[model samples]
Target: MMDALFITLQVILAVIAVYQFVFSLFGMYRKKKKAHFPATKSFAVLVAAHNEEQVVGALMENLKNLDYPKELYDVFVICDNCTDGTADIVREHGIQACVRTNTNLRGKGYAIEWMLKELWDMPRQYDAVVMFDADNLAAPNFLSEMNDDLSGGARVIQGYIDTKNPEDSWITAAYGISYWYINRLWQLSRHNVNMANFLGGTGMCFETKMLKEIGWGATSLVEDLEFTMRSVQKGIYPKFNYDAKVFDEKPLTFKASSRQRLRWMQGHFTVARRYFFPLLWQSIKERNLVKFDLALYSVNVYIVLLTFLMTAIMGIDAAVFNGPNIANIYGYLPLGLSFVAVGASILTFMAAMALEKVTFKKVYAYLILFPIYLISWYPITFYAFFTQNNKQWSHTEHTRVVRLEEVVQSKQV
Candidate 1:
């Protein structure tokens, strides 16, 4: 009876996975409609950098060349406890860069909060505030599209972030493909159905007033997720804008990738424990549909972890009890099918790539190794929950650099 019950729950979760897949497909269809709105507002572009001396100059150059008028957009770089020349490079270029040193408050979230406080003190009131990491290179039209979305009544907008080092190594290639698929399909789908979307740390724009009302503050390790969930709970779902693109570097080496993934895993586990119950309770008490969405998004990491555990248990059962020792045929069949379904779901990343118009030739080489990358998260996530190492922000290294002209040429063919 216990085995049957386990098998039943597996089948039910598998069905929910299928539902999410379908939801993603519909999102892709809806994304084809161009986001249209007038651009007649000013913006404050906030960049948080820590020891990014090598790439800060280039990022400033890219910001200078943005298509938006200089008077309309102001770029602010916060050098949070940097020992390097990150602040020097930005200030050297004549940009308004601030050097902040706080031993007590350390992390990108704290830096952002400080910057927000500075903005509030000034007489200037920006229509929107867009955040980006130090390494990201914005497209010329990034601000223009973000302005459109803000004018169209979106409180928050998440732009697409593509990798600059996709062709450098297999690890980087896999990471790049996963990012592209998620932004183009998963996020686009969720936005289409009015569901909450996870905020990719950089390239997200928030309305100035909304940020003020919500209070721009995040001390959590995964400040992006915490901020996103809080916004959703308040009934402000972030809109996805695929037309606004930001290019960033992928971790070139496995050591670097592991460190980055470890932080993400730890942050996810922390947020799930912190917000899951509150969101669930809020959903039940208020009968709020968006509250339920926020709760589901918060618990996704746990769900993935659960799915992996259940898969392992069923695999053991199939090997030991399927042939002669057990007469429970129903238990084996459903669990076996569940494993197949899970395997197939992992392949959906490939399908998502095809839908995004990423060339099959460009992605085929890394396809076979994709599953290995997916499974790697299991160990990191497990360790994150158990050990919880480095709750403080450990920024990933970004050395890869691709020009906007290169990205345009690649897309042209």
Candidate 2:
């Protein structure tokens, strides 16, 4: 009976791993097709910056170059408690920019909320409200694509975010690969199947009415995720616009990466604790299994923790629990199947990378270093759980300058 129970447990985990692998494969295929939407309406481009003077100038330049009517789309920059010349730089560009300073509310979420409130009070309502970080340099046709998606009945749209500095260091390369894999496999696959896609902090466009109806307030450490969950509950699944692109810098140092990831993990945990139960209950009450599946998947940190614990327990069982005389109770079949599941997962990841137009030469270099990069996250995840860290926004420095010419050159080589 004990042997049977062990086999059953292994089978369950293998099944889950297989399911995830298949989902990733689907994403690999769906990423190749570009979904083009027609640009038909006006938009409000909103940015929240805090001590980001270095990149604000270039960001404004990128925004100014977007293929949208200057009169139809307005750029609003909220300089949240910036001690630098962030506001002055925007003014220097001869653009109409709003600068808000608040030392009390120091987070990007609060800054965005303040700006949204101010915009809401205006006599004219924009057709769509687009959100982006100050460091992000949007593609020239970003607004045009998002405008098309918005007009095509998409309540919320999420675009692809690629790293602007993949060659800077190993850390940046790993981050770039992770971002590429997510955009190609996770987001693309989920969207192809009509599953929910989460907002990626920047490069997201939302219908003005939906934004206002959802209160346009962000209080969680991960306001984007919290807002996404709330939007899902209201029957709005974020749509993925493949052609809408945003380029941003990845952390060059491990310390900076850990700090940024820790905040993200903490915010994810906080959102899970606050909303998972409520969403699960609502899904059950309304008989909407799809939403329940999304809510459960949205809080994926628990799965990682659970998998680690399970693997550790299996290791201990092999070393400490099993008697020398007793034949290994858990059959090798289950163990072998588990490894197969892992293999399939790796294949799915690689397949997704291929679909994202990642060349074999580049992927080979990343594959050799992927294990070390993945292991590094374990320490960060551990610290995120145990540390009683302040929830204050931890900013990452972005110094990389990437132009379209550089990207084109890399692609050719």
What overall lDDT goes with each candidate model?
0.80, 0.77
Any residue pairs clashing in model 2, and if so which?
none
What C-alpha lDDT does candidate 1 achieve relative to the native structure?
0.80
Off by more than 4 A, model 1: 1-5, 31-35, 314-347, 360-362
lDDT of 1 by residue, 1-413 (tens): 76666657676666677767777675557446665666688999999999898888888989999988788988999999999888889999999878899977889889999999998888888998999998888999999999888878888889988876576777878888899778867887777777777788999999989998989666678888988888877778888887889988788777788889888888888888888899889899999767776787788778777767766666776788673332333455777785776666765676677676775355568777777888888877777777565577787866655666776676556
Backbone clashes (count) for model 1:
1
lDDT (Cα, 0-100) at 295 in candidate 1 = 84
Each model's total of backbone clashes: 1, 0
Tens-place lDDT per residue, model 2, 285-340, is 99986578667766566655555655566767769987332223335457886577
Candidate 2: misplaced stretches above 4 Å?
1-13, 31-38, 312-335, 360-363
Error of 1 at 300 (Å): 1.3
Please give the TM-score that candidate 1 achieves against the real structure: 0.90
